[model samples]
Target: MKNDITTRRDIEQLVNTFYDKVQRDAIIGPIFIHVAKVNWDHHLPIMYSFWAGILLEERTYVGNPMMIHEALNKKSPLLQYHFDSWVRLFYETVDELFAGRNAEYAKEQGSQIAQLMHHKMRESEQ
Candidate 1:
Protein backbone atom coordinates (compact mmCIF):
# COMPACT_ATOMS: atom_id res chain seq x y z
CA MET A 1 0.00 0.00 0.00
CA LYS A 2 1.20 3.50 -0.67
CA ASN A 3 1.92 5.72 2.29
CA ASP A 4 0.15 8.97 3.03
CA ILE A 5 1.90 12.20 2.15
CA THR A 6 3.42 13.05 5.51
CA THR A 7 6.65 14.89 4.93
CA ARG A 8 8.33 17.57 2.86
CA ARG A 9 9.98 14.86 0.78
CA ASP A 10 6.58 13.46 -0.07
CA ILE A 11 5.38 16.87 -1.22
CA GLU A 12 8.42 17.31 -3.43
CA GLN A 13 7.87 13.95 -5.02
CA LEU A 14 4.23 14.73 -5.61
CA VAL A 15 4.88 18.13 -7.14
CA ASN A 16 7.70 16.86 -9.30
CA THR A 17 5.74 13.92 -10.60
CA PHE A 18 2.69 16.03 -11.25
CA TYR A 19 4.64 18.60 -13.27
CA ASP A 20 6.35 15.86 -15.20
CA LYS A 21 2.93 14.79 -16.40
CA VAL A 22 1.94 18.40 -16.98
CA GLN A 23 4.99 19.07 -19.09
CA ARG A 24 4.12 16.16 -21.33
CA ASP A 25 0.39 16.67 -21.52
CA ALA A 26 -0.61 18.00 -24.91
CA ILE A 27 -3.69 19.78 -23.69
CA ILE A 28 -2.03 21.96 -21.07
CA GLY A 29 1.65 21.54 -21.82
CA PRO A 30 1.78 24.30 -24.39
CA ILE A 31 0.03 26.69 -22.06
CA PHE A 32 2.69 26.21 -19.43
CA ILE A 33 5.74 25.66 -21.57
CA HIS A 34 5.14 27.95 -24.51
CA VAL A 35 2.62 30.53 -23.43
CA ALA A 36 3.87 30.98 -19.87
CA LYS A 37 7.48 30.12 -20.63
CA VAL A 38 7.84 28.62 -17.21
CA ASN A 39 11.32 28.10 -15.86
CA TRP A 40 11.17 24.77 -14.11
CA ASP A 41 14.38 25.25 -12.16
CA HIS A 42 12.96 28.31 -10.44
CA HIS A 43 9.28 27.41 -10.53
CA LEU A 44 9.60 23.95 -9.03
CA PRO A 45 10.81 25.21 -5.68
CA ILE A 46 8.00 27.72 -5.52
CA MET A 47 5.47 24.96 -6.20
CA TYR A 48 7.08 22.82 -3.54
CA SER A 49 6.64 25.64 -1.08
CA PHE A 50 3.09 26.25 -2.26
CA TRP A 51 2.00 22.65 -1.88
CA ALA A 52 3.98 22.16 1.31
CA GLY A 53 2.19 25.06 2.91
CA ILE A 54 -1.21 23.72 1.87
CA LEU A 55 -0.61 20.12 2.85
CA LEU A 56 1.85 20.32 5.73
CA GLU A 57 1.22 23.81 7.11
CA GLU A 58 4.87 24.73 6.56
CA ARG A 59 4.17 28.45 6.13
CA THR A 60 6.76 28.70 3.40
CA TYR A 61 4.91 29.86 0.27
CA VAL A 62 4.47 33.59 -0.08
CA GLY A 63 3.35 34.91 -3.41
CA ASN A 64 0.33 35.91 -5.40
CA PRO A 65 -0.47 32.97 -7.64
CA MET A 66 -3.79 34.48 -8.65
CA MET A 67 -2.07 37.57 -9.99
CA ILE A 68 0.42 35.41 -11.80
CA HIS A 69 -2.37 33.44 -13.40
CA GLU A 70 -4.26 36.60 -14.25
CA ALA A 71 -1.27 37.83 -16.17
CA LEU A 72 -0.84 34.48 -17.85
CA ASN A 73 -4.49 34.48 -18.76
CA LYS A 74 -3.99 37.66 -20.71
CA LYS A 75 -1.22 36.02 -22.69
CA SER A 76 -3.00 32.81 -23.66
CA PRO A 77 -6.60 33.16 -22.55
CA LEU A 78 -7.16 30.39 -20.01
CA LEU A 79 -10.33 28.43 -20.60
CA GLN A 80 -12.34 25.88 -18.68
CA TYR A 81 -10.57 22.92 -20.21
CA HIS A 82 -7.19 24.21 -19.12
CA PHE A 83 -8.28 24.30 -15.52
CA ASP A 84 -10.01 20.96 -15.94
CA SER A 85 -6.87 19.36 -17.24
CA TRP A 86 -4.86 20.75 -14.38
CA VAL A 87 -7.20 19.38 -11.74
CA ARG A 88 -7.35 16.02 -13.48
CA LEU A 89 -3.57 15.78 -13.58
CA PHE A 90 -3.28 16.72 -9.94
CA TYR A 91 -5.82 14.12 -8.80
CA GLU A 92 -4.17 11.49 -10.93
CA THR A 93 -0.77 12.34 -9.51
CA VAL A 94 -1.98 12.25 -5.92
CA ASP A 95 -3.80 8.95 -6.34
CA GLU A 96 -0.77 7.43 -8.03
CA LEU A 97 1.57 8.42 -5.19
CA PHE A 98 -0.34 8.40 -1.92
CA ALA A 99 -3.51 7.36 -0.15
CA GLY A 100 -4.87 8.65 3.16
CA ARG A 101 -6.36 11.66 4.87
CA ASN A 102 -3.71 14.07 3.75
CA ALA A 103 -3.87 12.78 0.22
CA GLU A 104 -7.62 13.21 0.18
CA TYR A 105 -7.26 16.70 1.56
CA ALA A 106 -4.80 17.48 -1.18
CA LYS A 107 -7.24 16.48 -3.89
CA GLU A 108 -10.05 18.46 -2.36
CA GLN A 109 -7.91 21.52 -2.01
CA GLY A 110 -6.56 21.20 -5.53
CA SER A 111 -9.99 20.84 -7.06
CA GLN A 112 -11.23 23.85 -5.17
CA ILE A 113 -8.25 25.89 -6.20
CA ALA A 114 -8.81 25.04 -9.82
CA GLN A 115 -12.49 25.86 -9.59
CA LEU A 116 -11.75 29.20 -7.99
CA MET A 117 -9.14 30.00 -10.58
CA HIS A 118 -11.51 29.19 -13.35
CA HIS A 119 -14.12 31.40 -11.75
CA LYS A 120 -11.64 34.23 -11.55
CA MET A 121 -10.67 33.70 -15.15
CA ARG A 122 -14.28 34.04 -16.17
CA GLU A 123 -14.73 37.05 -13.95
CA SER A 124 -11.84 38.79 -15.61
CA GLU A 125 -13.42 38.36 -19.01
CA GLN A 126 -16.44 40.35 -17.85
Candidate 2:
Protein backbone atom coordinates (compact mmCIF):
# COMPACT_ATOMS: atom_id res chain seq x y z
CA MET A 1 0.00 0.00 0.00
CA LYS A 2 1.18 3.48 -0.78
CA ASN A 3 1.10 6.39 1.59
CA ASP A 4 -2.20 8.24 1.73
CA ILE A 5 -3.28 9.97 -1.44
CA THR A 6 -1.67 13.38 -1.58
CA THR A 7 -1.73 14.61 -5.19
CA ARG A 8 -3.39 14.38 -8.56
CA ARG A 9 -1.27 11.37 -9.39
CA ASP A 10 -2.54 9.56 -6.35
CA ILE A 11 -6.15 10.33 -7.18
CA GLU A 12 -5.61 9.21 -10.76
CA GLN A 13 -4.04 6.02 -9.56
CA LEU A 14 -6.94 5.29 -7.27
CA VAL A 15 -9.56 6.04 -9.92
CA ASN A 16 -7.78 4.01 -12.58
CA THR A 17 -7.24 1.03 -10.35
CA PHE A 18 -10.80 1.04 -9.04
CA TYR A 19 -12.35 1.37 -12.48
CA ASP A 20 -10.13 -1.36 -13.85
CA LYS A 21 -11.68 -3.67 -11.31
CA VAL A 22 -15.16 -2.35 -12.03
CA GLN A 23 -14.71 -2.90 -15.74
CA ARG A 24 -14.05 -6.54 -15.08
CA ASP A 25 -16.26 -7.35 -12.09
CA ALA A 26 -18.80 -10.08 -12.67
CA ILE A 27 -21.78 -8.39 -11.05
CA ILE A 28 -21.06 -4.75 -11.90
CA GLY A 29 -19.10 -5.10 -15.12
CA PRO A 30 -22.11 -5.72 -17.31
CA ILE A 31 -23.85 -2.70 -15.90
CA PHE A 32 -20.95 -0.54 -16.96
CA ILE A 33 -20.12 -2.27 -20.21
CA HIS A 34 -23.51 -3.23 -21.59
CA VAL A 35 -26.00 -0.93 -19.91
CA ALA A 36 -24.06 2.23 -19.36
CA LYS A 37 -21.49 1.53 -22.07
CA VAL A 38 -18.94 3.64 -20.35
CA ASN A 39 -16.14 5.04 -22.48
CA TRP A 40 -13.13 5.00 -20.23
CA ASP A 41 -11.22 7.54 -22.26
CA HIS A 42 -13.82 10.15 -21.54
CA HIS A 43 -14.87 8.85 -18.16
CA LEU A 44 -11.60 8.29 -16.36
CA PRO A 45 -10.41 11.88 -16.35
CA ILE A 46 -13.75 13.04 -15.09
CA MET A 47 -13.47 10.56 -12.27
CA TYR A 48 -9.98 11.77 -11.53
CA SER A 49 -11.31 15.28 -11.35
CA PHE A 50 -14.24 14.20 -9.25
CA TRP A 51 -12.13 12.44 -6.66
CA ALA A 52 -9.53 15.16 -6.73
CA GLY A 53 -12.20 17.72 -6.13
CA ILE A 54 -13.39 15.71 -3.16
CA LEU A 55 -10.06 14.66 -1.64
CA LEU A 56 -7.80 17.53 -2.57
CA GLU A 57 -10.34 20.35 -2.77
CA GLU A 58 -9.30 20.92 -6.39
CA ARG A 59 -12.69 22.26 -7.47
CA THR A 60 -12.08 20.74 -10.90
CA TYR A 61 -15.03 18.42 -11.12
CA VAL A 62 -18.25 19.84 -12.49
CA GLY A 63 -21.47 17.91 -13.00
CA ASN A 64 -24.52 16.47 -11.30
CA PRO A 65 -23.74 12.92 -10.30
CA MET A 66 -27.22 12.25 -9.02
CA MET A 67 -28.76 13.15 -12.34
CA ILE A 68 -26.31 10.94 -14.17
CA HIS A 69 -26.84 7.99 -11.89
CA GLU A 70 -30.56 8.55 -11.96
CA ALA A 71 -30.47 8.34 -15.72
CA LEU A 72 -28.51 5.14 -15.46
CA ASN A 73 -31.05 3.74 -13.03
CA LYS A 74 -33.76 4.39 -15.55
CA LYS A 75 -31.92 2.16 -18.00
CA SER A 76 -31.13 -0.62 -15.48
CA PRO A 77 -32.42 0.21 -12.08
CA LEU A 78 -29.65 0.30 -9.52
CA LEU A 79 -30.21 -1.82 -6.45
CA GLN A 80 -28.65 -1.97 -3.02
CA TYR A 81 -26.55 -4.86 -4.19
CA HIS A 82 -25.05 -2.82 -6.98
CA PHE A 83 -24.23 0.03 -4.67
CA ASP A 84 -22.84 -2.31 -2.04
CA SER A 85 -20.64 -4.02 -4.57
CA TRP A 86 -19.40 -0.70 -5.87
CA VAL A 87 -18.53 0.51 -2.41
CA ARG A 88 -16.82 -2.74 -1.65
CA LEU A 89 -14.61 -2.42 -4.72
CA PHE A 90 -13.88 1.18 -3.96
CA TYR A 91 -12.90 0.46 -0.38
CA GLU A 92 -10.81 -2.45 -1.45
CA THR A 93 -9.03 -0.44 -4.10
CA VAL A 94 -8.30 2.31 -1.62
CA ASP A 95 -7.03 -0.12 0.93
CA GLU A 96 -4.81 -1.75 -1.65
CA LEU A 97 -3.17 1.40 -2.91
CA PHE A 98 -2.74 3.77 0.00
CA ALA A 99 -2.74 4.18 3.76
CA GLY A 100 -3.43 6.93 6.30
CA ARG A 101 -6.05 9.68 6.62
CA ASN A 102 -6.66 10.33 2.95
CA ALA A 103 -7.10 6.66 2.27
CA GLU A 104 -9.71 6.40 5.00
CA TYR A 105 -11.36 9.55 3.80
CA ALA A 106 -11.51 8.16 0.27
CA LYS A 107 -13.31 5.06 1.48
CA GLU A 108 -15.63 7.07 3.71
CA GLN A 109 -16.41 9.49 0.94
CA GLY A 110 -17.01 6.68 -1.53
CA SER A 111 -19.44 5.11 0.93
CA GLN A 112 -21.29 8.37 1.46
CA ILE A 113 -21.50 9.02 -2.26
CA ALA A 114 -22.74 5.52 -2.98
CA GLN A 115 -25.39 5.81 -0.28
CA LEU A 116 -26.52 9.18 -1.49
CA MET A 117 -26.68 8.07 -5.09
CA HIS A 118 -28.55 4.91 -4.19
CA HIS A 119 -31.05 6.83 -2.04
CA LYS A 120 -31.68 9.44 -4.67
CA MET A 121 -32.05 6.82 -7.37
CA ARG A 122 -34.57 4.89 -5.30
CA GLU A 123 -36.49 8.00 -4.41
CA SER A 124 -36.69 8.97 -8.03
CA GLU A 125 -38.18 5.62 -8.89
CA GLN A 126 -40.90 6.09 -6.33
Candidate 3:
Protein backbone atom coordinates (compact mmCIF):
# COMPACT_ATOMS: atom_id res chain seq x y z
CA MET A 1 0.00 0.00 0.00
CA LYS A 2 1.08 3.56 -0.51
CA ASN A 3 2.11 5.78 2.35
CA ASP A 4 -0.28 8.13 4.06
CA ILE A 5 -0.04 11.89 3.57
CA THR A 6 2.93 12.81 5.73
CA THR A 7 4.26 15.96 4.21
CA ARG A 8 3.31 19.00 2.16
CA ARG A 9 4.41 17.13 -0.97
CA ASP A 10 1.90 14.36 -0.31
CA ILE A 11 -0.83 16.95 0.16
CA GLU A 12 0.18 18.73 -3.05
CA GLN A 13 0.15 15.44 -4.93
CA LEU A 14 -3.31 14.61 -3.66
CA VAL A 15 -4.70 18.07 -4.47
CA ASN A 16 -3.13 18.13 -7.94
CA THR A 17 -4.25 14.63 -8.83
CA PHE A 18 -7.72 15.17 -7.48
CA TYR A 19 -8.20 18.49 -9.34
CA ASP A 20 -6.87 16.99 -12.56
CA LYS A 21 -9.79 14.61 -12.43
CA VAL A 22 -12.14 17.40 -11.34
CA GLN A 23 -11.08 19.56 -14.28
CA ARG A 24 -12.06 16.77 -16.66
CA ASP A 25 -15.07 15.36 -14.86
CA ALA A 26 -18.24 15.64 -16.91
CA ILE A 27 -20.57 16.48 -14.07
CA ILE A 28 -18.37 18.94 -12.20
CA GLY A 29 -15.81 20.11 -14.73
CA PRO A 30 -17.88 22.88 -16.20
CA ILE A 31 -18.67 24.30 -12.78
CA PHE A 32 -14.99 24.55 -11.99
CA ILE A 33 -13.65 25.52 -15.38
CA HIS A 34 -16.36 27.53 -17.08
CA VAL A 35 -18.15 28.81 -14.03
CA ALA A 36 -15.50 29.23 -11.35
CA LYS A 37 -12.67 29.73 -13.79
CA VAL A 38 -10.23 28.30 -11.31
CA ASN A 39 -6.67 29.29 -11.93
CA TRP A 40 -4.83 26.09 -11.11
CA ASP A 41 -1.52 27.86 -10.78
CA HIS A 42 -2.90 29.83 -7.83
CA HIS A 43 -5.49 27.38 -6.56
CA LEU A 44 -3.20 24.36 -6.26
CA PRO A 45 -0.86 25.80 -3.67
CA ILE A 46 -3.75 27.09 -1.57
CA MET A 47 -5.24 23.61 -1.72
CA TYR A 48 -1.93 22.08 -0.72
CA SER A 49 -1.89 24.25 2.34
CA PHE A 50 -5.53 23.50 3.04
CA TRP A 51 -5.10 19.74 2.93
CA ALA A 52 -1.76 19.83 4.63
CA GLY A 53 -3.35 21.77 7.46
CA ILE A 54 -6.31 19.44 7.62
CA LEU A 55 -4.39 16.16 7.37
CA LEU A 56 -1.11 17.11 8.95
CA GLU A 57 -2.32 19.83 11.30
CA GLU A 58 0.26 22.04 9.66
CA ARG A 59 -1.81 25.20 10.30
CA THR A 60 -0.91 26.51 6.88
CA TYR A 61 -4.27 27.29 5.27
CA VAL A 62 -6.41 30.25 6.17
CA GLY A 63 -9.16 31.08 3.75
CA ASN A 64 -12.89 31.51 3.66
CA PRO A 65 -14.35 28.48 1.93
CA MET A 66 -17.88 29.37 2.93
CA MET A 67 -17.58 32.75 1.22
CA ILE A 68 -16.06 31.23 -1.87
CA HIS A 69 -18.55 28.41 -2.24
CA GLU A 70 -21.40 30.70 -1.35
CA ALA A 71 -20.36 32.93 -4.24
CA LEU A 72 -20.11 29.93 -6.52
CA ASN A 73 -23.59 28.88 -5.50
CA LYS A 74 -24.93 32.26 -6.44
CA LYS A 75 -23.27 32.07 -9.85
CA SER A 76 -24.45 28.52 -10.54
CA PRO A 77 -26.41 26.91 -7.79
CA LEU A 78 -24.71 23.77 -6.57
CA LEU A 79 -27.01 20.82 -6.24
CA GLN A 80 -26.66 17.55 -4.40
CA TYR A 81 -25.15 15.85 -7.41
CA HIS A 82 -22.29 18.32 -7.44
CA PHE A 83 -21.38 17.65 -3.84
CA ASP A 84 -21.83 13.94 -4.38
CA SER A 85 -19.53 13.88 -7.35
CA TRP A 86 -16.97 15.98 -5.50
CA VAL A 87 -16.95 13.69 -2.50
CA ARG A 88 -16.75 10.65 -4.72
CA LEU A 89 -13.77 12.05 -6.55
CA PHE A 90 -12.11 13.07 -3.31
CA TYR A 91 -12.48 9.65 -1.72
CA GLU A 92 -11.36 7.92 -4.90
CA THR A 93 -8.30 10.10 -5.07
CA VAL A 94 -7.39 9.39 -1.48
CA ASP A 95 -7.88 5.68 -1.95
CA GLU A 96 -5.75 5.66 -5.05
CA LEU A 97 -2.82 7.35 -3.37
CA PHE A 98 -2.61 6.39 0.27
CA ALA A 99 -3.94 4.07 2.97
CA GLY A 100 -3.70 5.14 6.56
CA ARG A 101 -5.22 7.33 9.25
CA ASN A 102 -4.48 10.50 7.37
CA ALA A 103 -6.01 9.07 4.21
CA GLU A 104 -9.20 8.15 6.00
CA TYR A 105 -9.17 11.50 7.73
CA ALA A 106 -8.99 13.21 4.39
CA LYS A 107 -12.05 11.36 3.12
CA GLU A 108 -13.96 12.02 6.29
CA GLN A 109 -13.02 15.66 6.28
CA GLY A 110 -13.89 15.99 2.64
CA SER A 111 -17.33 14.57 3.34
CA GLN A 112 -17.88 17.00 6.17
CA ILE A 113 -16.71 19.92 4.11
CA ALA A 114 -18.96 18.94 1.22
CA GLN A 115 -21.92 18.56 3.50
CA LEU A 116 -21.23 21.87 5.14
CA MET A 117 -20.88 23.60 1.80
CA HIS A 118 -24.09 22.08 0.50
CA HIS A 119 -25.98 23.10 3.58
CA LYS A 120 -24.56 26.59 3.63
CA MET A 121 -25.25 27.10 -0.03
CA ARG A 122 -28.82 26.02 0.36
CA GLU A 123 -29.21 28.43 3.22
CA SER A 124 -27.76 31.24 1.16
CA GLU A 125 -30.34 30.67 -1.52
CA GLN A 126 -33.19 31.31 0.86
Candidate 4:
Protein backbone atom coordinates (compact mmCIF):
# COMPACT_ATOMS: atom_id res chain seq x y z
CA MET A 1 0.00 0.00 0.00
CA LYS A 2 1.18 3.51 -0.76
CA ASN A 3 1.69 6.01 2.02
CA ASP A 4 0.73 9.61 2.53
CA ILE A 5 3.66 11.95 2.23
CA THR A 6 4.57 12.77 5.80
CA THR A 7 8.24 13.61 5.99
CA ARG A 8 11.18 15.31 4.31
CA ARG A 9 12.29 12.01 2.89
CA ASP A 10 8.89 11.55 1.32
CA ILE A 11 9.11 14.98 -0.23
CA GLU A 12 12.53 14.18 -1.63
CA GLN A 13 11.26 10.95 -3.08
CA LEU A 14 8.26 12.63 -4.66
CA VAL A 15 10.35 15.43 -6.12
CA ASN A 16 13.00 13.08 -7.46
CA THR A 17 10.51 10.68 -8.98
CA PHE A 18 8.51 13.48 -10.55
CA TYR A 19 11.57 15.11 -12.08
CA ASP A 20 12.72 11.78 -13.42
CA LYS A 21 9.55 11.83 -15.47
CA VAL A 22 9.85 15.53 -16.22
CA GLN A 23 13.36 15.12 -17.60
CA ARG A 24 12.02 12.64 -20.13
CA ASP A 25 8.76 14.38 -20.92
CA ALA A 26 8.87 15.31 -24.59
CA ILE A 27 6.68 18.31 -24.02
CA ILE A 28 8.72 19.97 -21.28
CA GLY A 29 11.97 18.07 -21.18
CA PRO A 30 13.80 20.29 -23.59
CA ILE A 31 12.56 23.31 -21.72
CA PHE A 32 14.41 22.10 -18.66
CA ILE A 33 17.39 20.34 -20.16
CA HIS A 34 18.03 22.59 -23.15
CA VAL A 35 16.22 25.87 -22.58
CA ALA A 36 16.70 26.33 -18.86
CA LYS A 37 19.68 24.03 -18.62
CA VAL A 38 18.63 22.98 -15.16
CA ASN A 39 21.32 21.78 -12.81
CA TRP A 40 19.62 18.81 -11.27
CA ASP A 41 22.08 18.71 -8.42
CA HIS A 42 21.07 22.23 -7.50
CA HIS A 43 17.45 22.15 -8.56
CA LEU A 44 16.36 18.94 -6.90
CA PRO A 45 17.37 19.94 -3.39
CA ILE A 46 15.61 23.24 -3.73
CA MET A 47 12.48 21.44 -4.82
CA TYR A 48 12.71 19.09 -1.85
CA SER A 49 12.79 22.06 0.45
CA PHE A 50 10.05 23.85 -1.46
CA TRP A 51 7.63 20.95 -1.29
CA ALA A 52 8.59 20.14 2.25
CA GLY A 53 7.78 23.70 3.24
CA ILE A 54 4.44 23.46 1.50
CA LEU A 55 3.46 19.99 2.61
CA LEU A 56 5.28 19.76 5.91
CA GLU A 57 5.34 23.40 7.02
CA GLU A 58 9.09 23.28 7.41
CA ARG A 59 9.57 26.76 6.03
CA THR A 60 12.94 25.94 4.52
CA TYR A 61 12.50 27.25 1.00
CA VAL A 62 13.20 30.85 0.09
CA GLY A 63 13.17 31.89 -3.54
CA ASN A 64 11.00 33.56 -6.12
CA PRO A 65 9.80 30.77 -8.36
CA MET A 66 7.70 33.14 -10.40
CA MET A 67 10.67 35.27 -11.29
CA ILE A 68 12.67 32.23 -12.24
CA HIS A 69 9.90 30.92 -14.45
CA GLU A 70 9.35 34.32 -15.95
CA ALA A 71 12.97 34.39 -17.01
CA LEU A 72 12.64 30.92 -18.45
CA ASN A 73 9.49 31.91 -20.29
CA LYS A 74 11.34 34.82 -21.75
CA LYS A 75 13.86 32.40 -23.17
CA SER A 76 11.26 29.96 -24.50
CA PRO A 77 7.74 31.21 -24.63
CA LEU A 78 5.64 29.04 -22.32
CA LEU A 79 2.31 28.01 -23.76
CA GLN A 80 -0.85 26.70 -22.15
CA TYR A 81 -0.16 23.13 -23.13
CA HIS A 82 3.17 23.21 -21.35
CA PHE A 83 1.40 24.19 -18.16
CA ASP A 84 -1.16 21.45 -18.73
CA SER A 85 1.56 18.85 -19.15
CA TRP A 86 3.24 20.06 -15.97
CA VAL A 87 0.09 19.78 -13.90
CA ARG A 88 -0.68 16.38 -15.38
CA LEU A 89 2.79 15.11 -14.62
CA PHE A 90 2.72 16.46 -11.08
CA TYR A 91 -0.60 14.83 -10.29
CA GLU A 92 0.59 11.59 -11.81
CA THR A 93 3.69 11.69 -9.63
CA VAL A 94 1.87 12.31 -6.38
CA ASP A 95 -0.72 9.66 -7.10
CA GLU A 96 1.89 7.13 -8.07
CA LEU A 97 3.82 7.50 -4.83
CA PHE A 98 1.26 8.36 -2.21
CA ALA A 99 -2.37 8.44 -1.09
CA GLY A 100 -3.90 10.65 1.59
CA ARG A 101 -4.66 14.19 2.62
CA ASN A 102 -1.14 15.44 2.09
CA ALA A 103 -0.90 13.76 -1.27
CA GLU A 104 -4.17 15.35 -2.34
CA TYR A 105 -3.03 18.66 -0.94
CA ALA A 106 0.17 18.48 -2.96
CA LYS A 107 -1.80 18.06 -6.16
CA GLU A 108 -4.10 20.90 -5.23
CA GLN A 109 -1.21 23.24 -4.53
CA GLY A 110 0.74 22.14 -7.60
CA SER A 111 -2.24 22.78 -9.85
CA GLN A 112 -2.76 26.22 -8.40
CA ILE A 113 0.94 27.06 -8.66
CA ALA A 114 1.06 25.96 -12.29
CA GLN A 115 -2.07 27.89 -13.18
CA LEU A 116 -0.92 31.05 -11.46
CA MET A 117 2.57 30.87 -12.91
CA HIS A 118 1.21 30.23 -16.37
CA HIS A 119 -1.15 33.16 -16.03
CA LYS A 120 1.58 35.45 -14.82
CA MET A 121 3.87 34.37 -17.63
CA ARG A 122 1.16 35.12 -20.18
CA GLU A 123 0.46 38.49 -18.64
CA SER A 124 4.13 39.38 -18.76
CA GLU A 125 4.24 38.43 -22.43
CA GLN A 126 1.41 40.87 -23.16
Off by over 4 Å in 3: none
Error of 3 at 104 (Å): 0.4
- Those runs of model 1 whose alpha carbons end farther than 4 Å from true positions after fitting are none
lDDT pick, better of 1 and 2: 1
Give lDDT tens digits, candidate 4, residues 35-83. Answer: 9889999999999999999999998899999999998888898899999
Clashes of each: 0, 0, 0, 0
TM-scores, one per candidate: 0.98, 0.97, 0.96, 0.97
- In model 3, the worst 10-residue window by lDDT is 117-126
**How much does candidate 3 score in TM-score?**
0.96
User: For model 2, how does the per-residue alpha-carbon lDDT over 1-126 read when each residue is reduced to its tens digit?
Assistant: 369899999999999999999988998999999999899999999999999998999998899998898888888989999999999999999999899998999899899989988887777777
Descending-TM-score candidate ranking = 1, 4, 2, 3
Better by TM-score, candidate 2 or 1? 1
Candidate 1 lDDT by residue in tens digits, 49-87:
999999999998999999999999898888888888999
Worst 10 residues of 1 by lDDT: 75-84
Tell me how far the alpha carbon of residue 48 in candidate 2 is from the true structure, in angstroms, after superposition: 0.4
**lDDT against the true structure, each candidate:** 0.94, 0.91, 0.91, 0.94
